[model samples]
Target: MDQQMFCFQCEQTAGCAGCTGKKGVCGKSEKTARLQDELTGALIGLARATNGGTLYTDDTWKIFIEGLFTTVTNVNFHDDTIRELMGRVHEDKEKLAPMCSGCGAPCGKTGDYDLSRLWHADEDIRSLKSLILFGIRGMAAYAYHAMVLGYTDEELNRFFCKALFAVGEDWSMEELLPIVMEVGKYNLACMELLDQANTETFGAPVPTEVPLTVEKGPFIVISGHDLLDLKLLLEQTEGKGINVYTHGEMLPAHGYPELKKYPHLKGNFGTAWQNQKKEFAGIPAPVLFTTNCLMPPAGSYADRVFTTEVVSYPEIVHIGSDKDFTPVIEKALALGGYTEDQPFAGINGGRTVTTGFGHDAVLGLADRIVEAVKAGDIRHFFLVGGCDGARPGRNYYTEFVKQTPEDAVVLTLACGKYRFNDLDLGTIGGLPRLMDIGQCNDAFSAIKIATALADAFGCGVNELPLSMVLSWYEQKAVCILLTLLYLGITDIRLGPTLPAFISPNVLSYLVEHYHIAPVSTPEEDLKALLHEGE
Candidate 1:
């Protein structure tokens, strides 16, 4: 059969390989996937046109970032919206290079790149370029979040253009490899930029306990990673008697002082993005998706689904540029939340989950942590974090965290924590055994905490008793992995499946240099990670 679509940029792609059938594992139809590719191609074309002498302005950078973000898994599934984005990209390109449109023999220098070439290229080249492309796609998400908060880096903007331009070039492995690594370098910068934007804008997050109960009356469940949306929703719903509970990535918003100050911003609503289908189905409140990880809504809750920013679905109400969440508010009020307080619990049966151990919060406890380690009260540290999904083997993360030794501490971030965030691991010294380190972008905080611990002990980060067992589902996790590699952190175990985009040659190189390994059984991997038999 002829290939209808090809996508492997996500972990749960069909069967550990590319999704090339009529629909993707994430519910993206073949039509939507094709438009996403075209949208990507158009962005590359714009990059090419801009490289031909037109400098990247704020407008250009915004379009480029949004275009890339739109193609990320579960971001935008509407073909019309994707086509609209392609139109905007093409319009920007035409404006930048007006003469190219009219030229008769246009040499194909500034035309939209045909992605099939890259898709069908030699495996190693495809692998290296895929790293660059997907890495920047992930980084664009951070950049987009930062941009919304008025944070823009010239260097970061320029890198997007440079990387997009390289994707269209027929570069060799030697030529593309540096750009691949550079994606990691710049993703670190992007994550840092987002960290600053979030902390500075929302106040440094403090350790905060969030309940799982849905308070009586009208309520809104905001999901995805946009804190700005949550803030606005809180503001609009303040006097309206509607409560706002975070779902998925937005759960960490409770740790921010500015966000937490809102009395109506009650608690977290669901476990993880993967559970949204089941959890949101019967909820009495509307769910607003502000970014990716938006699974197509099941028919039960389809009407209650609203999208904003780059997240779009056909026929779903989209809160547009004005950021007016009025429709979402009205939907919440109309739904009329649970009549009485409805209690919910996380996957591990705890009624509350704690978040906000950002760099500042963790580093504030540096002295106590260092002393505990020195006194041998803390035997090891495990950074078990990343995206979560519905795939079967994902239970590995829950089991891995479950099997952790008592003297060890587990630092988790992102939606992956839903696996076991509610488990009562008790305390180590004066701190909780399991620490929630904010969102995926807060991987910077994890890096800071690890590096600080290593610095206090006078050893490299790798030499510290730190191991990262991550579960990845999408592009954001890809860039975070690159950042970890960029920092020279090694012995990382990534699962539930190795990326389908990673070619054997590239995988071997990562194994040889970074010691990156696919996650095996929780028992066996834990034994190896702890050096039990070595």
Candidate 2:
């Protein structure tokens, strides 16, 4: 059968093989997916042109990051946006390799790569390149968020181009393995830049209990990764009888003292990212998306979906370069919400979920945690979090959390926690059983916490009594998984299905070297984790 188009970059491909037909599971059309591949191929050519040269500049890095971020699942859903970005990539490539323009003698070099070659390459090579490509796509989300906060790092930017360049080159495992680890290393730097930008700009997040109740009145719901957008929305709606609620990843913003101070900044709205379509249906107020994990808007509530930052949905109101957010404010007032305060609750029936227990909060209690571990009061630490999705097997995360030993501590981050975060697991020692570690980008916090524990125990991170059971649905999780692998953090249990892009050989390599395993039944996996801890 002839392939319709290529899209195997996410957890839900068209047929578990790849998105070869007209549209992907995420609703990405074949035409748009092909353009994404072209944009990526152009980036690779630009990276190749910079080989062994110092010609790389900040502009080069920005284009590379933007290009990668655009390819992530649910970020850029418009064909026009992908086409526009491809034009920009081509323009940048021309500037980098002017010699390739009219040379009759083929250099075999600077021209844009035909992505079909990658689609048809050896499975192993294609898998490694896919890793490099997808890993950067995830890292680019963090980089884009950090950049929005006026923070930038040179090494992180440069490594992006280097990684993209390697994706185009003919490289084997011996050569690509180091580059793979480098992706993790640089992703750490990218994540740190974002963390510093967020903390420095908003202050260290403290534990915050976000309510689920929506007070009757004019209110705006802000989703995505852009704090600045949320800030602007709060400012625009201030004293205007309009309330603001955080949704999805934006729920963590409630932890920041600066944001939480807004009297009208009410509570969180929904559960995981996957539920946005159904949850947002008939939502009275406007919903602003600041970043990724944006599902295709359901027609029932498409009018209420407003996009800011890089999140674009066709026909939706877009708060552009000015960041005014006036349209969103107007939408809130027009909707006028419910007549009275409407009480809502999380999936677990809890009225609220506590978030913003970042690294600073957790590490402050390090002494108590270490003591609990030493006394065998806390038998295991499970980092049970990642991107959540609608997949059937995704119940593994909720089940995993449920089956965790009462003596163990659960550290979670990202939108994935919406599955079971509302359950009151109580506390082990002085630490809460379920600790929320900021946003998805704050996986840096989990990494920091893990490293700190390893340091205190005088052993490597893998040697510590921590196990990472991750669930991935998008590219950002790919970068984070790469970062974990880069840190030599082993024995990670990843699911609901290994990325379709990963070939059998590459999967075996990860299994053999990193002891990475797929998730089985929660009960079975819990037993294996406990055995490993012993």
Candidate maximizing TM-score: 1
Best by lDDT: 1
TM-score per model over all chains: 0.98, 0.96
Model 2, runs deviating above 4 Å: 1-4, 56-58, 532-534
Q: Write model 2 residue lDDT over 1-534, tens digit each, in one string.
A: 257487888887756678788888988777877778888888887777666335765477778778888888988777777788778776766777777777665554548777788788888888888888889889999998888788988778778878877777778878887888888889999899998999999988999888899998888888888888888888888899988888898888988888888899989998878888878896788888988878888889888888876678678887888988888888888989988888888877899899988899889999999999999999999999988888788877888899898999999998889989999999886679999997778999999999999999999999887899998888889999999998888999999988988889888988998999999999888888889556
lDDT of 1: 0.90
lDDT of 1 by residue, 1-534 (tens): 148599999998888888999999999998888888888888888888887435655479999899999988889999998888888888888888787777766555457888888889999999988989999999999999999999999888888989988998888899998888899999999988999999999999999999999889999999999999889888888899988899999988999999999999899998888888999899988999999789889999999999999999998999998989888888888989999999899897899999999999999999999999889999899999999998898888999999999999999999999999999999988789999997897888888889888889999999998888999989989898988888898889999999999999999999999999999999998899889987
The whole-model C-alpha lDDT of candidate 2 against the native structure comes to 0.85
Cα displacement (angstroms), candidate 2, residue 312, comes to 1.4
